[model samples]
Target: MRAAKRRTSREVRTGNRFAVLRAMYALGTPTRQELAGATGLSFATIATMVTELLAVGVVTEASREDSGGGRPRSRLKVAAGRGLLVGVDATETYVHVDVFDLAMTRLVHHDHAVGEGTSDPDRMVGEIAEGVRSALAAAPDGDVLGVGVSLPGQVEPDSGVSLFAPGWGWKDVAAQALLEERLDLPVHVDNPLKATTVAELWFGHGRRVAHLVTVNLGTGIGAGIALDGQLVRGATNNAGEWGHTTLVMDGRPCRCGRDGCLEAYIGVPGLMAQFGERHPGHRYLEGGSQTHFLAAVREGLEADEPEAHELVELFGEQLGVGLANLINMVNPNLVVLTSWAARDLGRWLLPVAEARMRREAINGSAAVVDIVTSAVPTNPVSTGMAAFVLEGFLERVGLPSPTSAPLRRLAEA
Candidate 1:
């Protein structure tokens, strides 16, 4: 009976160790005292866990800091080159794959286009798997902790299944399992917007900001909401579908079977369609149309072409109205607009949008929220994807102690 009790006690200790590790990963290096405070575990317990983690090379200690009043205290941080995390962004037109170190730095990145209207789930998975293999070949000799795939659709996180992605024509596919089987590593799958939001919260401008909204205006327009420091994923993990928000009662038909959605007005296809309608002679070279439009907008502003200026102003107005609704509803402290539209339009688009937002938002003071474009101009999505993987790693191993009030609350939940 004594032996049996010893075994049970050891099992409990092991479980507590895992819990503490997770807390540390989330906090990103905490002193022993801090770890204990965050995890709600005793100092003795944390010391034991930290010892074990250090023994296994999962964590390391930094130099001691002089406290001035007492013995110097040593800081602890997760070792940076210990492992790798994979990120995959499977979009309608292309598949972007990247590998990152524990610090969220991209080590390798590759992109390949997928044929339009291609709905073969198996083929898509195969292509992604190949990309992963290529990334692994380039990665340093560290163990891969996991692979995360971001899809532009509703995802059931628990099940790792994509419910529906009209853009990619995917439905009820177990993407996580497929990748896991192929890669033999832990797999996490989530909506692209949510994953991007997570990336921002941890590594981008959203860091340190409690409430923020990220608007990704690419082939499609989508919003990712972070409320009160937590991602607000609704019942179906589809809360931030701001693209389908109707701007006009019956203005224009959207691909999502809606009338006058923001996407119908601002999405890539929508913008091109509008341009085509107005300028019949305008021809787009392969993959050159978006660039040409941006050039036109730039030149038009300088040339004072009434037609081009009017088109851009209208685009900004519609975007501003939609953003105003979001600001009023979420009251976020920051709004990040990303994509070719925001990047290309630059200051030409923001002032007008800011004006409209000031007029329509609940808080007439637009000063409350800082609206900005993405800092990482090239491969923002891929960089964000890499950051997402880093976030998972940090959550599992680098956070503060679990006994602290803030960390305790997060752990308990």
Candidate 2:
């Protein structure tokens, strides 16, 4: 049997530092004592971590907290201007990049379009690199810590390889290495489900729930699951491919060459197919832009068009059925619909989906789960990728000293 790897002192220290930093980031400015309470670390350890953060200019001292007794504790916050982090969201239609500061404030957003079948590994890598460059160009003065990218389909977490991206026709692609080489920066890659889920966990409805599932609804469909406040990555890091599950026998053809898959009925393409069937000669259909088609559908719905209402009602019921299965399997307290498709159609879809979900779900599970639309104001996948880059930055901020050389150089600059 393979031996397990033990945690080194540096790793332990890094984890401790991240814990402290994450607590402060989430709780706003907090005293060392409060950080200790939140992270369950000793007060001395929190103090040491805070000192290291301060030395690196990654954190700054804020107003003192009233202790309600002696010795007012000084609050510390993550410094918003220390450095920048880049997040790349590579979807089927576009490669979107956003630059953010240490405090998670978005500084710039850049998007590059990808033509149909622009799935060559080299081309995708180049497009993503260009998008990141465009975003970084907007903030030339800040120190960019690292880049986190969200690629569609299955990704090998440890090696950062695109194991199998069906839409891109990529298998065993060295995505991380290629991106790092192209951009000359550290790159971390994962799928959209994981990225969007992390964003929801940090900034959306999942923040208040221990058991949460974030459903990614876009050109593709999947789920990102969290149980007991921990992200669930199954064996081989492919836990959330819920889109390929069989929803009906001999129903619709799926991209995975499967019949009756959930995605075939509810994904963006599936919805477009339904709309095309309803209105065989719509102008938006001729343009072949899913975005334009969805917009037109929304317009039609607002105008009380019978076809649009019928399509949405059917779509909602199908979506609810899918959610019911997911809820039954995960038994999560909350399921948040996220990504572009949900953001665009949520207001019209949520009520019908929820009602159908309750009817289809097991009564006990349905009673506890609350299905809601995403609350994140930004692109969730990109925002989550930024959070990932931030975590990586914090983990290695001061590797060998009170202030790492990199941080010192950035601060001096």
Candidate 3:
């Protein structure tokens, strides 16, 4: 009973601290009274938390804001200089990096593309480490939380081993350990689709959504499923590999050695291939210009070109059918689309997809589901890498615990 009470007390204190932190983050520079009002905590509690925050350098007091015809109130603002965060997206063809400060303001970012026949794990890890160091050099301060990496595979929890990346033909790579050893920083690695879902929750549509499904429509298709405010990681932490699901009978070939997979029909490469076939003499294919291809397609779609419109409608219905499968399976409340194909074409395809999804969903489940398009600014996987670490940062005061990882003392570095 005494131990139980101690545990309860600790829970209350932790909850109170998070409430204060979140309120401060949301309100920008708000006074203690405002924080109390926003969080429904007592003045004393707010004062205690503010004192703790100030002592820990998480927040700083600012001069009173000018109030028209009223007494000015002193405000507390987050200390943007407190520390830094680094995020890395270890993608198939590139290593994208972003550095952020305590306030989550992006300070520096860059992309390093992997050349053809050069997607080896050692070289990619070196690129990521070099990218982080380059981004860190541009930061205004040296204090860093840690590095978070998003990769395209099933990741081992707390261990940076990528079990497999079928698309890249990579398996059993200790990316996290290699990075941590060289960079000497806390490195958290996760699947790109899962990281995207977490990023949506932290900074996009998933904030207000309890049950959501986020689809990534890019070079390769994938999804992340969240239910009851928690991401659903299958037994192997690869639950949302929906792209490989069979979509057509004996259709286009996929890299996964399968025919008729959703990825075979709807991903950017597949669509581009089909487009090339449609207009045999089109230069977009010969030039390999995805930008021009998308622009031409969008122009054709807006002009009501029969062929372009037919392609859009057919793919929209197919996507809708895919979503209908998800809806029927999980009945999520919101469906968010992101990535190159989704972001570029989702605006036009959403309505048609949603309509077909409604038509195909069983027992009117689609009525409760809301369809929307969203993306993390700049890069989702990279931003999500930081977001993954940020969620832990928010729950605590600052920096990862030394015991969390061997190379965890980033501030000292």
Candidate 4:
């Protein structure tokens, strides 16, 4: 019982330190009083944590902030050059890697294209490693703390094994182990659903809202759910597979081998299929590339082409049903539509979908839910994955105290 109590005490201190660090990152150079307000910790606790962080060089004092009638309080910021984090977003079509500082400022970017319709796990892993190496090459000198990869599927939380990737027909792929072997750095792997949701919670539309749902529409589809300002990962950490839910009985087939799935109608492939039905054998279909086809569609939509208008109207209707179902069921205060498809078409598609959603969702839920496109400045998936790497780094750092192993392991270097 004493051992357990000690363990619990260490965990609580670690959590409190992490909370302080996260608040510091988010608030820029904030005073101790401001951090206390942001993290809901007492001012005394914030001051103690800040002193420890400063002693270890994890944080540094900035210019003092003068109160109206009292002594000036010193501001604090994360030591930007302490370490580096690499984020990889590997989907069915491409691999994008970005290197970020401790403050989450992206410093290097690299991209590697996967072969059209490539599904072989080995080839995809190679592409991902190549992209990560390219980003690391351009990054400034620092110990690369870790690589956080956003893969496209349900990932086993404990082992970092990709349990399923329907698009690539992957099953039980040892993604994290393979990448760590190739890159010789610690790798943290997760699905894009969780990564993007974390990005939104930290820096995007969901930051201020307690209940939020992010609907990702890319080569695939899924939902990232957050309730009470915490990410909801169910048993097995696969709670947000809303794309597989049935939207229409006996409707179009989905890549997951299901009929009438929400993904079947709104994912990139689904939107491409709908576009093909309208303009079969059109010039945009020559390459059989969804990205190329969507680019053409975006151009057409910008010009207000009649066919594009018709296609968007249909797309809006289908997406509306998906959003309405999510809103009614989850009752999120904010619903952010994101990923390649939404990024490309959301300008024209969001209003239509929002109008349709209001009609379908419950009045109370619909009235409160604000549906908007993702506003994250950087790639949401990669940025969120990088956040994971930072979290891991701090976990190793632990809390600054005599009993705590402050500056041990990677933090010491």
lDDT of 4 by residue, 169-239 (tens): 99999988988889999898988888888888777765466777888988888999877666777667788
Q: How many backbone clashes does candidate 3 have?
A: 0
Which residue runs does candidate 2 get wrong by more than 4 Å? 1-17, 37-45, 48-52, 65-69, 397-413
Regarding lDDT, does 1 or 3 come out ahead?
A: 3
Which one wins on TM-score? Answer: 4
Task: Estimate, for each residue in 1-413, the C-alpha lDDT of model 3 and write its tens digit.
Answer: 23322325555665566556655655678898888876667899888878877887878987787677788777988788878888888765567899987776788998777653456777778888998888888778767878888877578756669887765677898888989987998788888888788666556665455677888887678889877545677667788989888888898998878899998888767778877687776644555655556667777777777767766787798899999998898888888898767766776898999999999999667888998887456577777778666555644555221111110111112
lDDT of 3 at 317: 88
RMSD of 4: 5.9
Residue 42's lDDT in candidate 3 = 83
RMSD of 1: 7.2
Question: 280 in model 3: Cα distance from truth in Å?
Answer: 4.1
Every candidate's CA RMSD: 7.2, 5.9, 7.2, 5.9
- TM-score of candidate 3 on Cα atoms, chains taken together: 0.78
Instruction: Give per-residue CA lDDT, model 2, range 1-413, as digits (tens).
Output: 55655657886676667657656766788788777777677889888988888987889987887788988879788888888989889988888998988888888999877886789999899999999998898875888889999999899856989988878888999999999999999888988888887777666765466788999888889999877555677767788899999889998998878899999988888988877887788764768877777787788878888777877798899999999999999999899998777887788899999999999999999999998888877888998888777766655754332111011111111
